[model samples]
Target: MPTIRPSGPADAAVLADIWRASVRATHDFLSEAHFTEIEALVADQYLPQAPLWVIEVDGSPAGFMGLSGAHVDALFIDPRRRAQGLGRSMIAHAARLEGKLTVDVNEQNPQAVGFYERMGFRQTGRSPQDDAGRPYPLLHMRQE
Candidate 1:
């Protein structure tokens, strides 16, 4: 099992890299411009602003999860290190902190949606655009 720890602003650069790598692997529907824009935001804004936790495997950072109250704002694992239960570990850690987690998943990313569903989340609602008002649709989900 992986251990989770609190992350600070100093971890943003590396976490942003993980976010880019993970998104590149899973979010194949994103355009070049959109990817660039979102990447910048992840590094400059999101990672710094959100309360984050880092997941370490074998004493190295492998992934991160960002939380806002009971909601999951973001979760990303390094592409090379994915599918090894880092994501599941992060979610379980979050569950300990906040019961009944809620998350917004990108509808175009079937991998994420399916993963969330397999984690016992159900779609509670849908939005035509993302929280940032991007064209990508979002599925609001809550763990049950």
Candidate 2:
């Protein structure tokens, strides 16, 4: 079973690791160079500003999610733990905090889209590019 808890400074590195591992596994359309760039930004930039939660399995950090207002800013699970309900657990926890939740999923990543859809998020809109102006398209989803 997995447990969720508020994240602190000490969990930053673990969260970054999980983010990198998860992205590498599922974001096949992204280049290696992009991963390196994202890793740096997430570790030194994003994580410090977001209110994140860490998900642990057997006392080890397996994943994390960052919430900003009513939106899920980020969610990543260790590649090794994919499909084992860790991501679902993280989303469920986030929904508890923000009853109606929203998230932007990479359009290139069908698995993420499917997961969010299965979790009751409906496509509300889309963006031609990601927030960073990358070529990656984003599917805006909402669950109410």
Candidate 3:
């Protein structure tokens, strides 16, 4: 099993790479301008404030999860490492920290929604726009 550890300053660059690769792979609904804009914010602003934890696969960073209180702020895996259970491991680690977990999934990402459902999260609500007022719809979910 993979171990989850608190992120250090050194993990920032790789985490940003994972974020970019994962987002580009799954967030095709994002416009070029929107993607670029959010990328900068995540790399410079949001990531710095997030309580991040990294999962190493084969002695290197493979993915990470960001937490805010009991809510999942963000979770991303290297695009090449998807379907390898890295995401599941990250979520399990998050659950261990707080038995109850909440996350907002982009509605257009059915794969992510289904994965979370398989992991026992259920939809609690919906929003027409993301937290940042982006046009992407969001589906709120909770694991309890």
Candidate 4:
């Protein structure tokens, strides 16, 4: 059975691993240095502070999403689990909680942009640099 549950301390390591694998597969725009830096933060800083939810298939972790209020701070699924509807499930879960969810998608990741569009999100704005002032651009989106 597939289930969504709140993450506990013990799930941190597995979630971090999934985050790394998911980023490696989808975020090709991240430079090596930036990837290393962000990975460190995700494991040490971001994961610890974020309100996280894990999705499991057959009681095994397949993906996670980090949320802060209505904002989707992060969403990642194990690469092996791609195209399995986990991401869409997470987004739908978020929508029910937030009423109208918001997220920032990397402009360079057309796959993600299209996925959000298909999920009923529309671009509301854009930033030339990501939150950390990295060169990577971000497209701000809100559910419409």
Write one digit per residue (lDDT tens) for candidate 1, span 1-144.
678999977888888888888998999988899999988888898888887899988887899998988899888999898789888988988998999999999999999999999899999999999878889999999999
Q: What is the number of backbone collisions in each predicted candidate, taken in the order shown?
A: 0, 0, 0, 0
* lDDT per model vs. reference: 0.90, 0.89, 0.89, 0.91
lDDT of 2 by residue, 88-144 (tens): 888888888878899999999999999999999999999999999988999999985
Model 4: lDDT to the true structure: 0.91
Model 3 root mean square deviation, Cα atoms? 1.1
Looking at candidate 1, the ten consecutive residues that score lowest on lDDT are 1-10
Q: Which pairs clash in model 2?
A: none
Judged by whole-model lDDT over C-alpha atoms, candidate 3 comes out at: 0.89
Question: Considering lDDT, which of the candidate structures 2 and 4 is the better prediction for this target?
Answer: 4
Across 1-144, the per-residue lDDT of candidate 4 in tens digits comes to: 579999988888899999999999999999999999999999998776677989999899999998888898888999999899999999999888888899999999898899889998999999999999999999999988
Residue 135 Cα positional deviation in candidate 2, in Å, after optimal superposition: 0.5
Off by over 4 Å in 3: none
Clash-forming residue pairs, model 3: none
Candidate 1's clash total is 0
**Candidate 4 TM-score to native:** 0.97
